[model samples]
Target: MYQRFRSFFLLAGLFLLSACTSAGITVANAPVPFFEGTIERDIVFDEESKQTLDIYIPDRATEERLPVVIFFYGGRWTNGEKGDFAFVGTTLAEQGFVVVIPDYRKYPDVRFPAFVEDGANAVGWVHKNIGDYRGKSETLFLSGHSSGAHIASLLIVDERYLEDGTISAIKGFAGLAGPYSFTPEAEDVKIIFGPPSQYPQMQATTFVDGSEPPILLLYGRDDEIVAPYNLERLRRKIEEKGGQVQAKYYSDVGHIEIIGAMSWIWRYKAPVVDDLALFFRENSDN
Candidate 1:
C-alpha cells in the first residue's frame, strides 16, 4: 500500500511540473473516478471561439436547486482551456454544486479587458441559463486560481466588468493564489494589461469600496510566483473599505499546489476543495 501511494505521488509530482498544460492535468486526473457527476461541454457563452464553457452537474438526488460556481483556470493570461480543468469541475460538482468552467481569449491574441470581458459574458450566460441545469442563479459564486483569480476578483470588485444586476446576484467569490494587487513588471504582462496609466484598472484592489460581495482569499505561504503580499493588499483594502472578506493561508503549498490540490489525487496535500465548498455553502441562501 505504501509503495502504491509512493508511486502516485511520484507521478503527481512529475505532472505538477507542467500543471499549466492540459496534458499534465488530464493525466493527473486520469486515476480519479467520475461517477459522482455529469458534464456538459462546449456550451457557448459568447460569440467568440474561446467564449465557451463546461458545466458539471452532480448525480446525487436532490430536489433543491444546487448553488452554482463559475471557476476560471489560470495560465498567466496566456494559456488555459475549460477542458484542461475537468478535475476542478468534477470535484466541485461532486460536492453538489453546479460548476461552470469557461475559456477566455488569452494575451498576444487578445489583452486585458478583452479576457476580463469574456469572463463577464460567461457569467451573464450562466445567470441566464444555469437554471436549466438545476443551478440557483441567486446562489452563484465566482472562483479561480492565479490569473484566473485576478479575473474573478476584478469582476466582483470592479462594477464596470459585469452588469449591475449580475454583480449584485453573486453571493461570494473565492480566489486562490490571486495576483490581486500586482503591478505588471514583465514585458509580456505589461503588454497584456496595457500601459502604466491603466494598471490600476487591472487591479482588483483599486476598486474596493465596501459594496462588493463577500470575498474569500486563499493563498499559499510558500508561493513564489505571485507574492503573498498581493493577497494581503487586497484583504487590507477590503477591510479598510468595510467590505466582508476572509483569508486562508496554507503553509506548505506553493502556487501550483494551491490549485493542484483540488484534484483528488493530490487532495491529501490540502483541503482546498472542501474549503471552497464550505465557503460557498456558508454564503449561499440555499
Candidate 2:
C-alpha cells in the first residue's frame, strides 16, 4: 500500500534527470501497483544472526510455483528501507514472479561484506521458505540498483556468502545502471569503496566469472552518477567470460530513469523490463 502514481513517463523522466543533485542516490521512489488480496509475511533468514525477510505474493497466484525475484535497495551502502522498494513487488510480480525485497545492514552499522552476507542469506531464506508463497524457489533471480546491484553481483561471483550456510542460489541476475567497476578515485568515494573494504577485489568486474548464472544489464547514457566506463567494464567482464549479459542504454535517460524500467509493464519506454522477464523466463528452472 505505498503511494501509487498515475503518470509513469513524466515522473520517472524528471527523476532520472536529478542524479546530479546529491551524492549518488541508490534506490529511487517506491511506487506500488494496484493489487488486492496479496499476502505479506516475514521469515527469519538467520535467527541467531539477526536476519529476516519480507515476501510479497499475488492473490491470484497460488496453484503454481511462481518464480521469485529478490531485490536489494541502494543507498551508497548507507541508508535504505524495505519500504523504499514497494514498487518492485507489483511491478515485477505482475509479470508472474514472486518478489522479495530485504533491508540489509548499512554503513556505520556494518560495511561491504555484511550487506552482501545479509543479501545472500536473505536469498537463502527465500529459497528455502518461498514455497509458502507458492514461489518457484529453484528460479530465484537477483537484481538491484547501484550499491544494491553491487551486493547482488558480489554474492553471485564471490561464492563466499554461501560458504558459511545454505541460501537458495540465484538462477539469473539483472543490474540497473549499476557501478560494477566503479572508479576508486574521489576521497569520499574511496572511503566508501576503497582500502579496508576490499574495494579493488569487491568490484563486480573482477569477479564476473562465466561460472555464474546468466545476466541482464541496463544503463543510461546520460547517467551522471556512475560513469559509463564502469558499465563498460562490467559488460566486458561478463561477455568475455562466456556469461550471458545484455545491455540497454537510453541515450537521453539518466541514472534514475533506469528505475522506471521496473514499471515498464505500464510505461513501456525501455525494453529493460521485458528483457529481464525474458531472461528469467528463458533461464528459469521451472
Candidate 3:
C-alpha cells in the first residue's frame, strides 16, 4: 500500500510536469505589467550560443546597488530554457534583486561536469560584470529548482568548480526542491552523472565541510520525483560540519508545485518567492 501510494503521486507528478511545461511557457511569456521589471535579454556568458543569460532589473531604478541572484531552471539536466523562467527573474527583480537566468548545454550534447562547468563560468562572468547592471557583486546569491538546484548547490559546495576567490563571492544559496544527495540508479541520470566512481564528485553533500555559504533548502512533503531524503541528508551533513543551513518542508506541495508557486498565477499555492526573498535579505551582507 505504501509503495502503491507513492507510485500514484509519482504518476500524478509526471502528468502535472508535462502539462505545466506547456502552460508555464505561455504564462511566463505573457505580459505582466504590474511587475514592471526591465530585462536585458540574451547576454552571452560563453562562446557557445546556448551559454547565454537574461537579466531582470526592478523598474524603479537608482544608483544604489541591488543584491544579485543567479537562478538556474530545472529540466533533469536534459531540457529547459531560460525563457521558461522569465517569471522567476521578473518576480525576484520586482523585489529589488538583479536576477539572471542562464541557459546551459543539456545532456547528450554534454555530460558530467560540462554543464556544471558552464554554471561556474556563468557565475564567474556575473562576478566580473554584474556591476554594469547596477548590482552589488559582494551581495550575490544563488538559487535553482530541481536539477538546477543541484547545479547551483554543487557550485557553492564544490570549490573546484570556480576559482578560490569566485567561491567566496557567493553570499548565500536557496534551493527549491533540489536533489542534493541522490546516488543515481536511473539510466538517464546515470548517463548524465555516472560511472559509479564519479557519483561522489557529483553530490553536493559530499563536499559539505562547514566552509560554504549559508543555504536555504525548501522541499515539498509530497514530492515523489525526488525524495525528501536528499534534502535531509545534505542539511544534516552541512549542520554536522558547522555550516549554516536552513530547511523548510511545505505540506501537500509536490516537486513542480513549489516552483510553480513562484509564478503570479500560482503564488497562492506557496510563498516560494517571498520565502526566498526573505532568506536572501536575511543572509546577504549588503
lDDT of each model, Cα atoms only?
A: 0.87, 0.71, 0.87
Higher-scoring candidate on lDDT, 2 or 3:
3
Q: What is candidate 1's lDDT per residue for 62-153, written digit by digit as tens?
A: 56689999999999999878787888888888888999999999988988888999999999999989988889987799999999999999
Candidate 1 yields a Cα-based lDDT of: 0.87
TM for every model, in the order presented, reads 0.93, 0.83, 0.91
Model 3 C-alpha lDDT per residue in residues 117-227, reported as the tens digit of each score: 999989999999999998888788999999999999999998889887777778899999999999998898898898899999999989998988889999988899989
Which structure among the candidates has the greatest TM-score? 1
Worst 10 residues of 3 by lDDT: 9-18
> Model 3: clashing residue pairs?
none
111 Cα displacement, candidate 3 (Å)? 0.5
Predicted candidate 3: what Cα RMSD to the true structure? 6.6
Q: How accurate is candidate 3 locally (lDDT)?
A: 0.87
Clashes of 3: 0
Instruction: Put down candidate 2 lDDT per residue, 87-143, tens digits, no spaces.
Output: 666667777788888878876777557788788778877777888788876777898
